[model samples]
Target: EALDGGPLARLHDGDLVRVDAVAGTLDVLTPGVLERPNVRPDLVANGYGTGRELFAIFRDHVGAAEAGATPFF
Candidate 1:
């Protein structure tokens, strides 16, 4: 939900996506895809409240789902 609610917030239906596992790359193929503004998440709300801060390390370092979404090597 991070990317969907963050950087890729502008993403919508019919947007083309390109993936190259061999080269380890993912791209949004839709034109102007990079031009849109990203949705900014509420930092305080995300990092605080309901004990969410307990997982701060994971929230800070985790990668994309396509990249296995792991924070460690």
Candidate 2:
């Protein structure tokens, strides 16, 4: 399934979820379900890969400068 956000977010109204299933119709599952398919397709397929890449970038950016300090609360 495709991750949400990124280029898809700008072009689409909702999040950029992956195409989980598209057999005769589009079967999408996002954080929330608020929309439905407009038309059906001829065949369907299933695949999986990284959903989003931005989160990784942010994590790496924030994770690199940890100062090795701990909280005392």
Candidate lDDT scores, in order, read 0.76, 0.36
Over 4 Å off in model 2, which ranges? Answer: 1-14, 17-22, 35-73
The per-prediction tally of clashing pairs is: 0, 2
The lDDT of model 1 is: 0.76
lDDT of 2: 0.36
User: Residue-wise lDDT of candidate 2 within 9-33, one digit each (tens)?
Assistant: 2333555555535453334446444
List where candidate 1 sits over 4 angstroms from the true fold.
1-8, 11-37
Model 1 C-alpha lDDT per residue in residues 1-73, reported as the tens digit of each score = 4555554676778999888999988788899877787775556756788988899998778887778889894
**Per-model C-alpha RMSD:** 5.9, 16.3
- Candidate 1 clashing pairs, residues 3+ apart or interchain: none
Tell me which residue pairs clash in candidate 2.
2-18, 3-51
